[model samples]
Target: MMLTSAAQAIGLFIATNIDDIIVLSLFFARGAGRPGTTSRILAGQYLGFAGILAAAVLVSLGAGAFLPEAAIPYFGLIPLVLGLWAAWQAWRDDDDDDDDAKVAGKAVAVWTVAAVTFANGGDNIGVYVPVFLNVGPAATAAYCVVFLVLVAALVVAARFVATRPGIDEVLERWEHILFPVVLIGLGLVILYSGGAFGL
Candidate 1:
């Protein structure tokens, strides 16, 4: 059962972080010309993800003391709202070249990347909270271990993909549209699976 739970946690971590590949790829591409930037990006990603994990664990443990399970799932709204907001921003900036300037003008700071990562992981928190709540302490610890290791793997994969030729062009062209749509879809999945809609 412990192994099974750990496997399930690994699967969940991958599912929630699939989009990180794209986001991290973009960050890497932006920093491709800079030295030592990859390390910063990696650090930022880890910090952001750790923050999300910590938040989920704290909330799940705290709320479990008093909140009903049904009420807990409503946390899915966080990602849903963030998704809608991202979609709106994409629409507003559909014709703008500001994204290029934003990427080029500044060195991507660790904290900036961290903030983006955390903000983008609203869905992760929503999904993780319930999973953590349902598991035993040992299982939870196993999940955390699995998540940390996989997250490192995720960063390496994103970096490789980002550095590849031709991929950056495609990502740059479609990112604005793709990112928000994925977020919205992820949000819906979380809401539905969490029974937030009572459906």
Candidate 2:
């Protein structure tokens, strides 16, 4: 029974965090070799996921969700605005500097990645709220522990993938184009999934 609960928690965490791993990979790809960047990304991921779980636990504790469904989609604006800003910066600074310097722009912020992770977690809240409600407190605690452990593992795995030779080279080469497009595309996807634009 304990193993079953643990398995359920693992599945839930994995389902909600696949995109997070991708986002982390993007961050790692962009921030590779930069001092302090990895720590910032890892911290941001934890902080952001903590926020997601906190929101879920609090909302579930309230015995219901407080945020209206429509408002959930509006959360996409966070990444949307960040992406546009990144795009503008990239456009403005098409310089003669090396790729490392070029890609090093402002992605090192812990809060920035945290915000992106949280923004990306709107769906996570939706998914977790119901599970938290159904599974009771002990199970929820177990899930949270499993989720946090998996977070570290996920970060390591993503970083490893991003830093791999061929993969790292390609990611480094295309980070400028890839970065903003990914964030914007993620935002649009979030919005679209929520029917935010009626499309």
Candidate 3:
């Protein structure tokens, strides 16, 4: 039962945010050749994700404890709005261009990427909160561990792929094809799970 519940939570998480993970991996892939920097940034991101998930799970569990039953539905709406907003933003800005250039130095851009990572991950918290509420404490830790493992794997894979001679060129060329699809797909999943359309 514990394994089943953890699997369910993991499924929901991946269904809702796998695209973001992919894009984040790709973004970090730009720094791939530099193992030290890439690893540091990836570590920071994983830490941030773990922290947020822990806080969100605690908050949700607490809210479920104290809040009136009627208010729970409203909590679900947070992800709805976030998902729609993410979709809209993706629709609006299909371009992958960024204002910030990659720093040539080895300094960890923890704050900058962390800010973006947090914002990018905000909607996911709302989605995961509901799923987390259904799991036990032990399952929660298991879920967190599995998620961290998947993320670490993605980072390593992206770094490895980026080192290939022509892969970056291919990825860069296909950003237009990839970004919108991922954003829209993730957004729709979150939107549906959040019951944004009232279905």
Candidate 4:
């Protein structure tokens, strides 16, 4: 059961971090095989994700203590609505996250990367809070471990993607459609189960 829950946690991590992959790819491209860039970005990503997780856990703790069980599921709407909006924007060729990521510009440092990671993750906090609340302590612990491990995997994947030319066209063509679908699926599951995979 614990192993199953740990495996299921990957979906939550992916759902919450839909845009981060593209952003990380761009940053990796900016690195252009520069020294220390990869290390800095990895540190920043971990630091930023840690911040998000910490904040979500705290908020979940408070909400779990005070909120009724039935109400907690409604928080799934956070991801659902964001997914819809992202889909709409992507459909219209108007995803501005690329623009936002570009503002990170030529300067790539740990703090800069961390700031971008945290700022971009703001919306994820809403989705995470309720998921954490309903997942129970044991499952949440498993999720944290799983999620932290996946962060490194995501970074490596993004860096690999950066090395590939014309990947943007592929990403542009399907990234939004794919990830938002997952987000929407995850949201519905949370709404239905009040946790992931029935916890």
Show pairs that collide, candidate 3.
Answer: none
lDDT per residue for candidate 2 within 44-98, as digits (tens), equals: 9899989888888888888344676567787899899988987888788777566
Per-model TM values vs. the true structure: 0.66, 0.92, 0.56, 0.61
Off by over 4 Å in 3: 32-35, 63-108, 170-199
lDDT of each: 0.72, 0.84, 0.55, 0.67
- The list of candidate 2 runs beyond 4 A from truth reads 63-66, 96-100, 103-107, 197-199
Write the residue-wise lDDT of candidate 3 on 67-166 in tens digits.
3333333343433343355456545654654533322222445543444445456566666676666766777777777777776665566556654578
Query: Per-residue lDDT for 151 in model 1?
Result: 81
Error of 1 at 31 (Å): 0.8
Clash count for each candidate, listed in order shown: 0, 0, 0, 0
User: What is candidate 1's lDDT per residue for 1-199, written digit by digit as tens?
Assistant: 8789878987898888887887677666556566787889889889988987877787777854454456545655654675687679667765775655545522557875676567667567768887887886778888999898888899999988976779866665665665556656755765677677785
Query: In model 1, which regions exceed 4 Å deviation?
Result: 63-106, 169-199
Better of 2 and 3 by TM-score: 2
For each candidate in turn, give its C-alpha RMSD to the true structure in angstroms.
Answer: 5.1, 1.9, 7.1, 9.1
Q: What's the candidate order when arranged by decreasing TM-score? A: 2, 1, 4, 3
Error of 4 at 58 (Å): 0.6
